[model samples]
Structures are given as C-alpha cells and as structure tokens.
Target chain A: MIDFIFHFTMIAAMIIFGLIAIEHKNLIYSAISLAVMSVFLGIIYFILNAPYVAVFQLVIYAGAVTVLFLAAISLVTKAKGEEED
Target chain B: MLPLNLLWWYLGAAAALYVIGLYALVSTRNMIKTVIAIEILIDGAHLNFIAFAATPTAGIDPIAHSIVITSIIIGGCIAAIALSLAINAYKHYGTIDIKKLRRLRE
Candidate 1:
C-alpha cells in the first residue's frame, strides 16, 4: 500500500536524522538535524492520521524550538569584535 | 489483507529512538546536545502513547490525544527554560564543558 511505503521511508529518514543530531560535533549542525528530524516526525504523524499533532509538532517544534536553539547557539558563540553591538 | 503486525513498526521505532536519546544523554558533553536528547526521549514516549491510541480495534481515544496535547505544551516550556539556563551557564563559565565547571575545586 502507498501508506506503508511512505511510512517506512519517513521512519528510516527520521532515524538517520535523529542519530546525526546526536552525533554531530557542531551545535548548530545538531540543531539543524534535529529540526529536520522533527519535520519527518511531523509527516509521520500526518500519515498516522493525527493531523492536529502533526501541525503542532511542525509549528511548535520545527519553528519555535529550533529558533530558540539557534538563539542560544548565537548567544553562546559570539565573536569578539561583534561584542560592541 | 493488511498485516496485523504493523503496530510493531511504530513501537520498534519508538524503542530505537528512546535508546538513541538515552545514549546521547549519557555520551554527549555539550549541554545543547543533552537538551536535544531529552526532547527526543519525550518524542519517543509521545509516539508510544499515540500508537496505542490509534489501534483500529481499540478505537481512537480522545483522552489520550488531549493528554498528548498538554504534554507538548509542557515539553516546549521545558525546552525554552532549559536553553535559557544553558545560556546563563555559558555566560558564567565561558564554556559549557562540564569538566571545567567545578567551582568548589578552585
């Protein structure tokens, strides 16, 4: 069935991206990978017929949480000369 | 006929994710990675909840869905507060390395 195929593919992708987020050295890359994994998870939710959960996952997680992560990364990794601003 | 064993797919994936998240939490040195791992662990648990609620014969449970919705809001709050705490820790220590964070030694 089409649903089965889609579900399997997304699940595989999710596993890889999640692992990459955990194993990456750079914090920013890890955050980016986490966002990608979240998107895949959202799609899985959609496929599983939980539209509300999927939408919230994309909006709250892929949007707000990733932004929060980048903001924290930015604050912590500030350049020396840019401190005046 | 669709195989009845399909539920195992979701459950297996959830178990694998939880294990990976636990490994990340234990092995990673960075605070941000730890936070991400925690999020992953919560997501795995969320998947398990939904998987059970989604069974065809058992019928969808609105109650489980409502609980998951609340958990999402709470998880978001936890992530925000944890990241802010990490920011403060970075400011105080100049680095997030846990090994260098011993204040009582100095």
Candidate 2:
C-alpha cells in the first residue's frame, strides 16, 4: 500500500510538472519546471526498480539538461549592453 | 511480473504524458517550449519501456535497461543541439517566437 501511494504520487507530480514546464510563459520558469519534472521521473524509475536508469535520469535530465536549458535562456535573453560580452 | 493493476496504472500515466506532450507541441509557439515538448515525449517513452521491464519472473531486463540508458543519452544530446539551434535562431531573428520568425522570413 505504501509503495502504491508513493508510486501514484510521484507519477502525478511528474505529469503536473510537465504541464507547467510547457505552459509557463517565462522561459526560465519553464526550464526549472522541467528539472523538477525530471526529478520526479527519476523517482518513478527508482520505484520501478531500475536504479541505474533512475541515476541517469537524475544526472542527465535533472542536472545536465537543465543547466543546458538555463544557459541557452541566459545567452538568448541578455541585455543589449551585455551582447558584446 | 508487476501486478496487472500496477502495470495498468503505469501504462495510463505514460499515455497521459504522451497526450500532454503532444498538446504542448501542437499549441506552443515558442522554440524552447517545443524542445521541452519533445523531452516530455521521450520521457513518456522511457516510462513505457521501464513499466514493461518490471516483470518479476525475471529480474529487470538488463537489455531493456541498457536501451533506456542509451535513449537517455540520445535525448540529452538532442536537447542540447535543439537549444543551440534555438539560441542561434534568436540571434538571427531577435525573437524566439515561431510566428514572429515566420513573419520575419516573409
């Protein structure tokens, strides 16, 4: 029962965060939401008993991918004065 | 094997993810949002793969797990490339909105 509860909760959170990631108007906020959703996805993998996949999901999606998105957002949105840098 | 009930639950969640991602892809005009929609779609497929691999009769299939890992790596690469392209597009067009970009092109 506890496992079921945890599984269901994580799955629900993943879906909610995914929606927020795509629907949020601000690009930075959308990237953060994607990271949060990825975290929940890692937890889901753990629940499914794929520890290795969970670790990859956390490290790649939550860590590397989020950083990449944030970097892209910052690069693309810099002020006019900062564009020369 | 995972209980039939649990399997159904996981499958349903995967389907929901697919639908959400598809809706976002179709409705969103922002380049970054389109990339995000793609990530969500890939994640949905990963969930489907993992859900099916959860059979108890045999421990989690090593082959399937490896495939999922490979897919994850590929998905990361795709996101990086797509974001780079989006950044380049923004540099050239001064906006990330696809509609604006189309107008600028014409």
Candidate 3:
C-alpha cells in the first residue's frame, strides 16, 4: 500500500512538473520546473532500488542540467538587448 | 517480474510521459522548449527501462541501472550541444524562433 502511494505521488508530480516545464512562458520557470521534475524522477528511481541511477539523476539532470539551462537563458536573454522569446 | 497490475501501472505512467513530451515537441516553437521536450521524452524511456528491470526473483537489474546512467549522461551532453547551437543561432539571427531560420536553408 505504501509503495503504491509513493509510486503514484512521484509519477503524478513528474507529469505535472513536466507539463509546467514545457508549457511555461518564462524560460526560467520552465527550467526550474524541469529541475523539480528531475528531482521527483530521482526519487522514483531510488524507490525502484536504483540508488546509483537516482544519484546521477539528481546530480546530472537536476543540478548540472538546470544550471546549464539557466546560464543559457541568461546569456541569450541578455545579449544585445535580446528579449525573451 | 512485477505483477500484472503493477506492470501496467508503471507502463501507463511511462506512456503518459511519452505523450506529454511528444505534444510539447510538436506544438512548441521555442528552441529551449524543444530541448526540454526531448529531455522529457528521454525520461519516459528511462522510466520504461527501469520498470521492466524489476523482477520478482532477483530484484532490480544492475545492467538496467547502468544503461540509464549512461543515457542520462548522453542526454545531458545532447542538451548542452543543442543549447549552444540555439544560443549561436540567436546570436546570428537575433531570434530563437525555429520558423525564422529560413536563411539557413537558403
């Protein structure tokens, strides 16, 4: 029962955040939502007993990937008075 | 192997993710959003892989975990390259809209 609840919650969160990430107008908000989704994905991985994979998801996807998105957003948005698309 | 009910549950989640990702990819015109859609698609695949790796007798398979890790790294690299390309395109064209790159074809 507990496992089922955990799975349901994580999957729901992943889906919701994923939609927010893709559909959000602001790139920063989208990127942050993606990070949140990644974190939930890592939790799901951990529940599935893939600890190493979970760590990598948290570190690579949630941490490094989000940072990359933020950097790119800032660079592009700030360049030559380029506005957000 | 996971029970039939559990297997379907996992598969359903994965499929939902796939659909969401594909919808975003097809509908969005922004370059960054396209990249994000790709990431979501990869994640859906990863979830499928993990779901199938679960076995009643042996627990989670180690090979599947390794595959997912490798995939995550590759996805990151792909995102970085794509973002850099998008940035370069923005620098040159002053716009991130995919529809505005007609000069590239000409």
Best prediction by DockQ: 3
User: What is the Å distance of residue A72 in model 3 from its true position?
Assistant: 0.5
Put down candidate 2 lDDT per residue, A1-85, tens digits, no spaces.
9878987898899999999999887789999999999999999898888999999999999999999999998888756553210
lDDT of 3 by residue, A1-85 (tens): 8867877888899999999999898999999999999999999887777889999999999999999999988877753544544
Query: What DockQ, between 0 and 1, does each candidate earn?
Result: 0.41, 0.51, 0.66
Ranking of models by DockQ: 3, 2, 1
* TM-score (C-alpha) between model 1 and the true structure: 0.90
How well does candidate 2 reproduce the true complex, by DockQ? 0.51
What would the per-residue lDDT of candidate 3 be over residues B17-95, giving only the tens digit for each residue? 8888999989988889889999999999998888777746556789998999999999999999999998998899877
Write one digit per residue (lDDT tens) for candidate 2, span B65-88: 899999999999999999999999
For model 2, the stretches where C-alpha displacement exceeds 4 angstroms are A78-85, B57-59
Clashes of 3: 2
Q: Compared with the true structure, what per-residue lDDT tens digits does model 1 show for residues A5-82?
A: 877898889889999989987778989999999899888777666778888888888889999999998888756542
What are the per-residue Cα lDDT tens digits for candidate 1 across B1-106? 1134666898888898899899998887677888899888888887777777777865676777778778877888889998998899889877665555565248
Off by over 4 Å in 1: A78-85, B1-3, B102-106
How good is the docking of model 1, by CAPRI class? acceptable
Better of 1 and 3 by lDDT: 3
RMSD to the true structure for each prediction, in A, is 3.9, 3.6, 2.2
TM-score of each: 0.90, 0.92, 0.92
